[model samples]
Target: MHRTAVVPCATPPRATRRLALALAPCAVTTAPRAWAARETASTMTPGTIRKQIFNDARGRATTYPPWMLGEWTCATTFVDASFPRRDVDARALARVPDTPGFRALSVARVPDVGREGTIEHRVRFVRVDGKTREDVGFNLMEIIDAYVGADAVEAVTTDGDDRTTIRLKPRASPNAERIELFTNARESGVEGDAFYVRESFRQVSLGYGTEYGNARVAPTDYEHRWTYTPLPDVPGGAVDETNVNKVHVKLVTAAYVQGQDALRLTASSNPRGAPVPKLGDAAGLAFEPVIVYTHVSLLERVGCVP
Candidate 1:
C-alpha cells in the first residue's frame, strides 16, 4: 500500500464541483517502480497488453507516487464508442443500449454513436499516513449529480474497506430506486518514475429501469487504464499554458456485459433460497465489450491536499 519513490509535490490544487471522471489507484502488492519501457501517447491505446507488465493489486488498498497526489482539473473528451461483436446473439446485444453503461454515454454527451464530446471536472487525491488514496464517495456523488442532476443522487456509501455503493433516485418512477455497486477492484502499477495505472472493477446496477419498467438488475464490468506522463513545472512547460504544474493523461475506459444466457440464468434464481448458478463455461463467462471510451487530458494541479 506504500510507494517508495516520491516525486516532488507541485502547488496545491483548488477544489470544485465540475464534470470529470477521476481514474484512481487500488489495492496491489508491489510498490510502484520505474519501468524500462515507458508509456507514451502512441503506446497507450485501447486493446493493448502493455498494462500486463505491472503487478496486480488483487483488491488491496494501494498508493500512488507523490507527484500524482493532489486536486486537479481533468479536461476529458469522449473519443469513441462501439459494440464490435459479430458472433454473439443479436438479441442479447440489443439489450445493451438499455443498460446503465450505455445510458452514461448519453449523459456524457458523446454526440452520435461514433462521435465525440468534451467535459471538464475536478478530482482530488490526498496523502494520508505516507500513502495516497482517493475520496471515492465524494467523487461519485459529484459526478452523478453533475451529469444527471443535483437531486438525482440520493447517497454514496462505503462498506468495510473497498465496497462502495452509490444510491440514486429512480429516473422513471418514485416507486423505484437505482443503485450502483463497485464490488471489487484490481489495480496495478509499474515500478519507478512512471505515472501509469491500470484498474478494473466488477460493478452492478439495479432498479435502472426504462420508461417501460424498472430494470431489475444489470451487471457490468469496467476497465480503466490511465497513462500519465509528468511535465516540468517551469514557465511554458505545462500542457495547458495557464498551469505550469501538470501531467498529460491518456485514459481508456471499457464496459463489458455478460451474455444474455448468463444474465437470464442469474436473474431467474433466488438469492435467498438457492445459490446463483456459476458461469462455468466459456460462453457463460464471456463478457463482451459493449462500449469503449478513450480520452486525453491535462491534469493541472489546482491545489494540494494535506
Candidate 2:
C-alpha cells in the first residue's frame, strides 16, 4: 500500500501502535538456533554472555541494531517465571495486579530509505501465531530534524543454563533520540519472551477545553520501540511446531498532552523553597490530553529461520 506525507505545517494521524503482547499458559516456545547464533555474536567476551543475574553494574549503551525482520519471531508470552516485576515503575502497576504482563507478538517494518520525509507502518494484533485478530492501522512519525538516533532492548533466556553474567558499564551517546533510557546495565535485564512497545513522542499543537488540563493534538514527533526477552533452547529441545500459543487483544488508549501552568521539576527544585521553572497559562487557556488508542500483538514466524 502507498502512504505519503507531502505537506508541512500539518500532522498525520498517529498509527494505532500494537507492541505485540500476549498471555499464554505455561507453554514453552523454543526459539530456533538462529536466536542462539545472534546472542553469541553480541556477548561482551567469548564463551561469556552478559545476561541478567543477581548483580549490579551499568553497561554502556551501544548503538545496537533495532529488531527488524529476519531476526525476530512474533512476540510470544509464556508463563514468565522470571520476569523482573520489581523493576517496573510503581505508577505503571497501580490498579493492576502485580502478576500481570503482556507477552505478545509485535510487527515493525521501517524502510532503510534514510531521512527523507517520514516513516509509516501498521501494527497488527493476531492470534495463535497464525490468524489476524485485528489490523490496528498504521501510524505516522514525522521527523524533527535530520538527527536520527539508535538504541536497543536485548533479552535472551538462558534455556535454564547457568550462563555467566558480565558487568555492563554505561556508554556515552547511547540512543539516537534525545532521550536516554535504561542506561545502567543494572537497569537492563531479561526474562520470558514478550515484546513491550513504547513510543517517544514530541508534542505538536494544543488547544483548551472546559477541563483543568490542556486540549490534546497528534504528536509532531515519535519513535517506535519493539523489545522482547526470550529463553534460547541451547542444548536443543523438541520443536513442538503444532502447539499454538493463544493471542489476547489489548486496547491501549493513553493520552499524550501539552503541558500548561505545570512547572518542570528537577533534582534541586522544591515548591516550598527553591525556584522551579514553569510553563505558561497562555492567556488563561488550558488543554486536555491527546487521547491515543492503540493495540499490541504477539506472533511468531510462520517458519523458523534456518
Per-residue lDDT over 118-213 for candidate 2, one digit per residue giving the tens place of the 0 to 100 score: 332222232323322221111111111111111111111111111211111123112111121121121222223333333322322222334677
**1-306 per-residue lDDT for model 1 (tens digits):** 111111222222222211222111110111222121234433443333221212333365557667767788776654433333333343444444543244442221221122234445566678778887775655554444444444455666666445666666555223125554543544557534346665555555566445576465655555666777777777554343234368777666555555554454334346678545555532433443433555677777888778
Among the numbered candidates, top lDDT falls to: 1
lDDT values, one for every candidate = 0.48, 0.23
Residue 299 CA error for candidate 1 (Å)? 1.7
State in Å the error of residue 289, model 2: 11
Off by over 4 Å in 2: 1-198, 203-226, 229-256, 261-295, 300-306
TM-score of 1: 0.61
Q: In model 2, what lDDT does residue 58 have?
A: 29
